[model samples]
Target: MAFALQGRDQSLVALGCRKRYIRGPRRADALVGASGPAGSGRPHQSGTQQQRQQKQPLLAEQLWFDEERILVDESFEAAEGAQLSPHLKVAKHVGSGTSADVYKLQGDGKQPELVLKMAKPVPGLRRAFQREWMLGRRLNAVAAAASELNMIIHTGPAVVSEDKKGQLVFRGTVLEGINGKSLDSRLEKDASFCDVDFIMMMLQQVLTALHKAEALVGFQHGDLRISNIMEHSTDPEALQALRDDAQTWQAQGFVSAESAALAKGLLTFKILDFGHSKINERQARSYLKLSSPNMNTPADSAPAGSSSGSSSSSSSSSSLALQRLPAAKGPLEAFYSFWYRGRSDSWRLLRSLATRLDGR
Candidate 1:
């Protein structure tokens, strides 16, 4: 599908543009006291107790592809009155995945509730967190003005720390906490309150945001499963009030005021987990080349009508279509081609969801 950013959304796109580089806070910066272990760092149960705990089913977020754990520096902020400093108070560990450890955070009175995602300190995993930080910084730059377009969680200022050897390390990232649950959580339980229209609207909102991201900076969110999609719990009454306030402002010819009012909590669906995202033209080209179907397979040179060739022909045709997309094509052509490639896992996920919804 050829998705273009709407003209009206141009300003919205610029609203989250991070044009400048953001430096992490150094040791000279105020330090939030090191976050202590959850409730006095008690030891775990032994033998059957531990085995029984392991036997229990994992939460949606905890179900990572692997369980190799790595210890990392968790003290990223300074201490303040009975709470962690830097405007974030660590609440508790929420979940863990191969990429990052997720934690719920209680923001100081001046800040909103947030989540902290600390990447494992393993060498191979460093680039993943760096990519996520880069993308988040880009999105966060515009969040102050384009609150509605702040679909992806807003990350607070980067907190830096040093290892024992004196090398600087990215302790973790603090992100805006959503008032609602992930789509997986909702889908696994009673979602009767959200009608089909609402669900579809949420889907549309997410796709629109993705399209905007592609148009502005050629970002492909590599992970788009149900767990990565968050539906905001913004109340209907609050939304309605915002609409009313916007209308009132509009009537007074205060166009900017109206937009500001409407932008408040206008976001419904947010696409998360850009840890695997491919950013910009170079990365996109590399991804396409890596993922293109039948790049040099035997079927590419096989004679017509054979079963192998016949089956591969369909896949190859799609690949050919992507190749044939003109180099001088419009801004969205690259995004379209990338999404249509056979290895586009997120596209497959969308298709699966559509099939399931259609069946229901």
Candidate 2:
């Protein structure tokens, strides 16, 4: 596929025949400056009122602007010693996002390197946890039946633990092992290492996973970038087999056949993270502007397809929905074929590989 730079022109089509767009109203606080009764500053007051006023502290302990204090309580370190369940031990901190903090956990002895993705105590993140947990379960079910989908990371069963008062606390989902280094890390280490053949293999596997996911789950991977792609170290024999296949494809004129260290078949790629994924619900709109990370603004939203612009509102006050273009079929298609606006991780990979190839 050719990599081209183009401006995005998407439609904001609702999923089903009757589209329902979720929009958040922009909160505009009006600061009105008022003087006591329009210049009647010194008004007489009752003795009881004056006495009560005098008793009140001039500087209230609680400030209205304490909203910004949300940052102080948003530390990922707070979950350092936290535990998911009696069996699941939340260990070292792995990563943090706006809605959740990822921790390396030790599950059953058989699965020592498990990951626990615990959502922060934010109401807005409820959907994120739900989406991920549901999607993970669906993928796992599919993988269990189909061996082709083995590439998709299978998340463990989701658990909803309670706090001290027996109230349902934040939601959490356990993922398989740490998987492998992200595609970004590998490229950062050696961008030049990705030749045409290697790119083809990676893309082939990723696209394969995407097609399966879409067909089986009826949803799209909202965020498909280098970082979201994981590269697993493979065996030497597998690497040789991949190299042989590439050579065959090259001879068939299907690929340019440029030679580069393929990391052997040693590098198998797996798609990671479903935080931005959207289900194919007929009642849902094609385009969504979530207030969570990777979904802050329309510019950062994932591609679904094209549709007519419309507007709707979300039940949560934090969410803001706008009338943008219709969603495309995931970011992968958008990346290779500039059918929409915004950055595509797949497109970036293609461009980077092209640049590296030209340099050589």
Candidate 3:
């Protein structure tokens, strides 16, 4: 099945029909702004009144403007270290999902080309939009661990202004676009293409990625299907040679980790579409560790088709609700507990692979 871009238009927002949708109110009632500088001392004033006019040393005087000015006129400056910015010129239609549209960015001298994901104008989809943005930020936050990641680098959101009121709106994000086709695309062309060797190599890569992904972000690869797995475009000749000699590679194998570098790169895939991926609200980094003793994959666990998210919320104000996961403490330990507990990202990946193979 195709992820958002390919053919799956279904959205996570649409799935949870009971969830609340924050309506877009016409105006923000109040903004917590800084107070004005202290008046030179009113000796006769009451203690309470004195507090209201308290002098500001480091801060400037209160510069209150109409509420409209705060939101409608000003664009949100990117958070201190964020890669957020206004949308670049769109080159063409890349794809559309239930909540957003993806586009190829126009070339510019200042930045490498990126893919822009713009949220649909519908207000109901805001949370889903925010969820994806947050997920990207989470992944990028730990990108130094890139040696272990397979997901694309999420640059951040696109900003736009409404034509009617000129209000600055956070439209969506910019992504590091890759030259590629989905695993599904690759499979659809040749069902028998994924021989044992190819699939096994891909599986190894997937497991490593999921392990790190769970540690840094989460376990539920909400949509772990063929469409979300990108097979980077490779030299046709090189690819044909590998495909032609799959059995040979399978039998002989690589002499070293460095051997068959080209084949590895071609078979290795990058994952995308975080719109449905969920994470811990309290501390994402600490919760999905692979070190927990209870996280091992069960030898007799139910097959991939069983439902995953079965755990309930642990505390008030926030709920984790991980998939069949035992309470995990850190990425190293957490992912292990996730594995031993009979459900994890690896399970989902294998399940998806199994389904794809069956279809093929």
State each model's CA lDDT, in order: 0.43, 0.44, 0.43
TM, every model: 0.50, 0.50, 0.51
Model 1: worst 10 consecutive residues (lDDT sum): 27-36
Off by over 4 Å in 3: 1-87, 150-153, 160-168, 217-219, 233-267, 282-343
Clashes of each: 8, 21, 24
Per-residue alpha-carbon lDDT of candidate 3 for residues 1-360, written as tens digits (9 for 90 to 100): 221211122221111123222322221111111112221111133344234224211110011101101111234332322333232456677787776777776644444456766677776454345445545545543442333442443444323333344222445566666666787786678654534334444545555465555554554555566678876432345655766675654455542221242233433456777655656544443332221223343433332223323221111111111123222233534554555454444445555565656533
lDDT of 1 at 76: 39
Candidate 2, residues 37-106, lDDT tens digits: the string is 2123232334443443344222111111111011111222335555444455678888888877788875
Residue 233 lDDT, candidate 2, scale 0-100: 41
Across residues 136-212, which tens digit of lDDT does each residue of candidate 1 receive? 64554323222223566655544344355534344456666676677677656742322333343454556545654
Q: Best to worst by lDDT, what's the order? A: 2, 1, 3
lDDT of 2 at 325: 22
For model 3 the TM-score comes to 0.51
